[model samples]
Target: MSEALASLLTALADDELILGHRHSEWTGFAPHIEEDVAFSSIAQDEIGHAAALYSLLAQRSGGDADGLALGRDAAAYRHAVLCERPNRDWAYTLARHWVYDTADAIRLEALHDTADEDLRALVTKMSREERYHLIHADAWIERVAAGPVEGRMKLEDGLKEAFEEALGLFEPIEHEEKAVHEGYLPLPSSELARRFRELAANKLDELGVQTEIYSRSDEAAEFVASSSGDLIASGDEHAESQPERARGLGGRSGHHSDEFQDLWDVMTSTYRNNPGATW
Candidate 1:
């Protein structure tokens, strides 16, 4: 169970870590400068959250957190598919931001009740910070979905398209059940996906965006590979193939998007060359 708890923590942290990298890509590319500042803060928040979670996992794994985060091969990461998908547009990004924050909030709430006192306390701290993220995302979802012209349609479409991938956010990594058995993390792995989807449906409806919500098995197969342009392209294939290995052809299984490798190269370039030097 301790090992399972560690894997579960690593999986959750990796999603935040990769998605934070994706969010950082918009540092100067957002439609509005003020929004750029606001979104950038969120990116930093996610990265910080990832760092804190990774620190705990590193302690458990008996390795350095930096290596755990940046040195691992793509196939070793256990982030959800939604986090790795490129932020093609502001609307799509916000759709994911809104949904993921809500889902994360609920998950953290469950974690706050764990029998492991330290883990419960850490999750409690995270839940406090997550309130701000939820506010920002909810405001954007409501305003965009309720106002404007073409933007509303685009936001709606983005929500619908990403809903399934968002559901994939709750997918379990290796040994999640052990965490439950040991009470290191509350909430049964089997029911977490369903509860996450239900919360999403309620939030989307309240924000005036309607979409279907679904679930996948914790051990469902990997995403199908695209033979054409990027799988993120509008017409690209989404749910087709299934790989036998956990680190298969998709983002969740540790296989990352092309963007992930590129991002990691840049993120670590400076740190790797100047190791042991003060920043």
Candidate 2:
């Protein structure tokens, strides 16, 4: 595979894998039994999608899919920081789910015309399942919006918190320009980001939710990922940095929040303990 294609695949797969793990965290703890089952099923689908993407990467890159998915170090993951965040509350979880699925749908739609036949076919397959996930997220979003004032407020707060970090979902990967130039990605990350913002705004407007979530200034270029997976200001030549400051930043470059280490440890424990073991 070309470097650009490999990077793109790795980013996509990592996002799915990490977010699926987060979704699975709600398996037993969801507010109700129906939600518990729903989230678990969604988690399974996401992880399955990750596995399929990794399998495609393995085929072209001569690597093991399991190894690619389970054996990578924390800093080696290319997921958006949003995916690795802890699900703090039902409202926040639903908010993040809606934003992510919306962006993911845009991404998959754009990939339908990719130059690579294999990738286009895989995208088509994934989109079939992803449609239901989008519906689930959209329904919950509308439900929360139409419910009690407190629930609506909390959901809005979640959107405010999640929207900025969600932008990292469209952060460019290494050699992304080449990928676009080659028709592997018909649209660039900037274009995708624009579409995400527009789509999100329209949806929120239609639902009578706050649409000011996109008003934040662009700070994406102000931070760089440190060696320890922390995000530090690019201009902070002499300033001390901490892992706690890593939110909403540096994910495309493999930088992650402190929470990622905990997630990584649990997610990879079995693979680390018994290398090459398979069920």
Candidate 3:
């Protein structure tokens, strides 16, 4: 209920929402049809997670869930920069998938024990879905890391590039201190960034892949800036001042890059023409 906790919730929800949108772009377009189905499920789960968290946030923000989602200006979104980065290829996307889900597991595990009953409950439920995402990413990481020369090369290349971007997954929630103080979220005292990287490295090592990780203090900040540029510039609100106090990237805070305007136009085209119409 505190401002701090509410901010953290907004950050968490926005990240999931934007990332879900990025993932949806690959639907029916992935390399294999079966993989398409699998990827679609992950994308849907992310959106579902975002919606659930948004429902929680809406309770505090005093707005309907849909409004929290579709009505917000881009600057209001608090998702990390990595979530907005373009999905370059299947390998890169999968690399991102593996790293993100692993980091999320670490985060959710800590949250599941929070004193806030509602938050704890949401984390508990999301934990189940996260398990599937981890499995999906892990399976593909191994798959691409094996068998042929081309596959291995793609996996290695993708992991190399994505590993740096994946560090963005640790982008700090602005109200972290308050969230912890209020018992709304409980991240472990142990170094989560370190643990997450170690886990990811181990997974890659098992698959005969070697990844180079940058210093978190530097990489996370960089990812946020670059990814936000891609998301906001690709749309219409590219000229807004950066959302300095909002925390995280452009769209989540309302200062979206121009690209989001374009995306918003398409995403809301149908709804705009017929406000109350149903499919």
Best by TM-score: 2
lDDT tens per residue, model 3, 130-243: 998998888887777786889788877766666655544554455555667777666632356667766776776677665453332233332233334332221223324543
Models sorted by TM-score, best on top: 2, 1, 3
Model 3 CA RMSD to the hidden true structure, in angstroms? 6.4
Better of 1 and 3 by TM-score: 1
Model 2, stretches more than 4 Å misplaced? 217-247
Model 2's alpha-carbon lDDT is 0.85
Report the lDDT of model 1 for residue 213: 27
Give, for candidate 2, the lowest lDDT window spanning 10 residues: 216-225
Judged by lDDT relative to the true structure, which candidate is superior, 1 or 2? 2
In the range 1-279, model 2's lDDT, one tens digit per residue, is 788899889999999999999999899999989889988999999999999999999999987889999898988999999999999999889988998999999999999999888889999999998899999999999998999999999999999888878778877776777999988888988788789877888898998986666554144424444565445545544536334442476788887888999999988999999976886
Ranking by lDDT: 2, 1, 3
Model 1 lDDT at residue 253: 45
Of the candidates numbered 1 and 2, which has the greater TM-score value? 2
lDDT, residue 70, candidate 3: 73
User: What TM-score would you give candidate 2 relative to the actual structure?
Assistant: 0.89
